[model samples]
Target chain A: MKDPRLLAVCCPDWPVVAACTATGTALHVPVAVVDGNEIVSTSAVARKEGIRRAMRRRAAEAMCPELVTFEHDPQRDARFFEPVAEAVEELAPGIEVVHPGLVAVPARGPVGYFGSAEQAAERIVDHIATHTGTEAQVGAADSLFAATKAAHRNMIVPPGRTPEFLRPLGVHELDAPELVDLLRRLGLKTLGAFADVPENAVATRFGGPATRQHRLARGVPERPLDKRRPAPELAVTETFDEPVERVDAAAFAAKLLSERLHENLAARSLACTRLGIHARTENDEELQRVWRAAEPLTPRGIADRVRWQLDGWLTRERLTSGIRTLTLEPVEVVDGTALQLGLWGHDDERAVRALLHVQGLLGPDGVLTPVIDGGRGPREQVRLVPWGDERTPTRNPDHPWPGRLTRAPATLADDPAALEDENGREVGVTGRLELTAQPKKLTIRGRTREVTAWAGPWPVDERWWAPDRHRAARVQVQADDQAFLLIRRDQRWFLEGVYD
Target chain B: MSRSATASLSELGVNPASELTSTTTDHATGRVLPVRGELAGLLPWGGLRRGSTVSVGGSTSLLLALLAGATADGCWAAVVGLPQLGVLAAAELGVAVQRLALVPRPGSDPGPVIAALLDGIDLVAVACPLPPSLARRLTARARQRKAVLIAFGAWPSPDVELTAESVSWNALDDGAETLRRQQIAVRSGGRGSAGRAKNVLLTFGEEEIELPLVAGGPDRSDEPADAGPDRADELAARRATTREQPA
Candidate 1:
């Protein structure tokens, strides 16, 4: 069957452009966006200076010392791209954002209106450049995958010619790294080579995901775009008694609405790939946009999209009032059997639901899960992340940190305390790790106790190069039945933890 | 009377028959989450019984220890309203930290939050004090959901109550060694099978605690302490073996 022709708009290095636009950095300046330690995207100027994607940040900096770098934030990129998507939507309605940098629409409406596919692409690209002041390329082909690839090269493949256009592309264009590597090892270096393999043989050798990629290689849709029409009741709407004027408020509402939408979809064993967000302003202005993804949207993914969209709308000067009504509707769905509960069993699902319920009651940051992180202090060693957020630790735990405590206290305290010697003089640690007084009495929160046992002053000097350097010495002292970890900093002793 | 004859007589009376059937069914289907080492002997049921409230008083380490075995056995546990909880200590005590969630500061009213957690989590340990009415309601909720509710502070009418009577820190001197191990004496008492007061000695070493495997008396000498992760694995393996034995 012939796949439906689609038109896709692509903005090269959108992250760099969005970063530049958000920070008001001129486009001529060399800029790169980094995720963690690696560069994700670079502006044209940086690319000219040999800064490539996946290059280490230090290498990029070493190559071009004047290059400005910004941490890659998807929400910021999406917020900046909203104007570009809006520009295209003015020329052609029913736009579906493939991601922050790309948007796709059915070619029939734009081509029929513009009289030719080339004219439609030209008009959309010109409209975006004029309205949003961003350079864009438009491509038209039989499938979204083919259209996206064509847009990257600014080409419009003629009707029924997508297979020819995709034939010479490298297998890396498939975007499945492992599958592409295996195909390259098997001498299928190009998409055409991979596509030439027999369908039954490919299905037997390769698995389900590979089969879908094989379809994309052959210029066929990965699956028949069923675009199931979700039940009207599946659309979740929330009417704010006090209109949401702040981004944080909207984000909280988005999390709740997305959870409800996901629950409704999961009940029917469906997952949304395309979502439509609708909002009504207090002044009776209505606004809407649609977002599409290659895979089904998880709850967090849906919430992020809603938040980015709302942030774009709320921050822009077009809206005169706050949003009064918000709605989330699944535009396209698919069988969600793959999204079923994990092998950990049904209790996990129930627990997740309960946690989500509490999150709804007390906001997302209310319920948290702990991750053991790398640090010298007990409080710094454990990072508490919100229930549904990523559980990645900020610092790597494997690095051997000197002067760390051998045993962690069962409880942590931040109370102010006084450590004094028997002579009634306050004790202190000298700069050379010398204690001014050996014997001491501990006074904590108005209660004084005699110190029975004592330990050394373990000094920690961190971030000595920066202006906010911290220099503190820790001591373990036992007073009566209680043992406390005390830190002497800025000439005062404060209780850090309790070994209960 | 013979067992068969008593059963026949009960079957002749409708009320007695239904009551007898309910009691037998409840006993047969009662689920118990495993506890670690010798700690099991302190509880009447030899484990944490589902739908029962167990309160731990005066010891945060004991509360964390109670959650370790069940979490390692694949049970989800959550702690509510204890912001100062030492998660690192919990990890060192063999709790599967990944399966544990913390609602550290649930604000002034933590009743709804704890109740919601009780609905989903297999075991919930709450340190916040709640009103008597809310506490009773939460207990009923836990019972309905077949979850274990662990109260950290004073609670009314719990199925089992554990208190730390004496605690001593080991491996510390005037100026030499650091604080390493701890010895705690925990006393348990409650209603029903747990009504009789019992005491157990738990030695918390650097990595994992040494609990006496036998219930005779507190034996603190000569038993080697295993590392935290290996002890968890051993407990998980033992649980698996126990589960398969019944099948």
Candidate 2:
């Protein structure tokens, strides 16, 4: 039997449309969605003013001065297009969303019911336009590529005329721009010229990418739609016969489920990089979370992540009901390589496993990794955050901190101690950021210490523009072999930290 | 020397079997990463032995000084339950910032924590006081995994027990205030080996740490002993530039 005809629906400038519509901007208003510095999509109004996709945002704005700019959010675009996809799904039981603003559906079922492919295409487009308040163009052809290209130009190609329709199209329509550019320089400018090259020659010269492009240029599906398998459920699950209310029980179960999942993945010579742990309570309440690793997850690493997730959900989330089902899904996977140690004894897998296990028991924030950051004070300069978390320091290290101290202390005290003078008078800073008294002594845990040597009161008055301002004078003092950093602020003396 | 002709000849001429056989040398026995120049003479093997425990006492600076070399050499080091560990001091002493992992408080009992760190890390420095039994078990685990365990507080008995004695501050003189130098007297002795007690002097300067030349070792002098990988890279780059320059 002949393959079922395919219908493609596409919405041009969907990101810009979604961004403008979400922000309550009119369609006639100049709008553009930018990814990084480059404009990803431009509205019809903006495009008319000479703004285009792939143009820099600054250049686009230069062309269209009144352009409403938005940072491109693929998640927001997909979220806004869900209703449009659902509208098509209603008419065609099984439709594939190719991307945020495009979808492909087998036309046989919908068109047979609607009497004709053109009638089916019109019905889908009208349903989406009315339901989603977005303009959509639809086309039907024997192959998805032809259908998509037809919708791209707002046309429909008859079943047997797909190749003829694709022939006059530019080689760039094959979507491998690098190969197309090279072929164009060689004077193969049209899809027909690219298609005329033998498949063997394309494979030998340009490899997999060019071969796929050549097939697409021949009006054949890059990969046949029927050859595509439904994405496999790569998750492992454990359904409790009786609900588990205790954290220990859930943690134990998570460990077992994690091992089982890892074993299944390992059998296929794959490793998970991003993992998702899901739990459903007896009352149907669900708790879902995703854990990402700096490196691939080992069996022990997976167990530790799952256990930490369970500990967090059970203790912190405070669910009303007990957990009835638990699932561990590897959201991302890569080919597994042999876990080999270098001659210098650097074993990353073992180290990661150990760290993950520690994180599980101590909580995610228990372990801290230290990074050298630019700041004046010892505590300010060293940034310590929970291990495995990616935190970019909010303060720019490169910015010059005026009146900042030069040397960092050896260690920062967990809590500050009071500083005093030789006469037992408290050392303090005045309203004008001046030291009230010389700091010669420090008292810690009832132990009075006298400084043998001392340095200046370097005043640091910062953030006077803000409501909360910091004003202090720092002094470095040495007592015997130990050195200390003392701060006097607001008529109070505090031991900032110590030198090793 | 056209690119296409050279590539085709190389592809056809290369013997795959000989290449594979030549590359397959047994590297199963993991070697201990060498220590920095300053502390290299202190250890018997010129480095911390893999699958061994070393007891570190006296000061946090000493513990950091011992680790700075191995960590700077690209080994991953994790400091567990060492809350008072001055990470800035470690960075200055020559530990690689990217290779060091700090777990200030690994809970009351850090057995599992230390074990996990030992699995993957080259050196796991644990400062918390653990029970004798637990310490023994962890040491055995370290031996099994071929990882080094550095005990900051105390352990029952370790292969090497290094203590910093007679530490004196030298930079603070006549109200100078800038503590640019320090002198530390380190004593080394351990179990199973000779009870030979050795004393060495370590000088901590602004940029690097060094050891004063002993009576017999005239070649050592006051050279920067703990010069890190940065120096090595600079040397490599200088050598490359020299090679490129015309005579």
- Per-candidate count of clashing residue pairs (backbone under 3 Å): 0, 3
Across A134-179, the per-residue lDDT of candidate 1 in tens digits comes to: 9999998998899999999889999989999999999999877788
DockQ of predictions, in order shown: 0.24, 0.19
Candidate 2, residue B32: the lDDT equals: 57
**What does candidate 2's lDDT look like per residue over B1-247, in tens digits?**
1223322332343322322221212122346565655454455444677888989888677788788877776678998886766677787777886667889887767777788788778999988888999999999998999889999877988888888885555444322234446556778777654145555666666445322111121233245532322222232233333323322
C-alpha TM-scores of all predictions = 0.69, 0.58
Worst 10 residues of 2 chain A by lDDT: A337-346
RMSD of each: 12.1, 14.8
Q: What is the C-alpha lDDT of each candidate?
A: 0.79, 0.67
Off-target runs (Cα >4 Å) in candidate 1 are A1-10, A22-30, A35-40, A43-66, A73-75, A104-286, A292-307, A314-347, A463-471, B1-47, B107-109, B189-200, B205-247
Q: Considering every candidate listed, which one attains the maximal lDDT? A: 1
DockQ of 1: 0.24
Poorly placed runs, candidate 2 (over 4 Å): A1-22, A25-328, A331-347, A431-434, A456-461, A464-468, B1-30, B166-183, B192-195, B208-247
Clashing pairs in 1: none
Worst 10 residues of 1 chain B by lDDT: B210-219
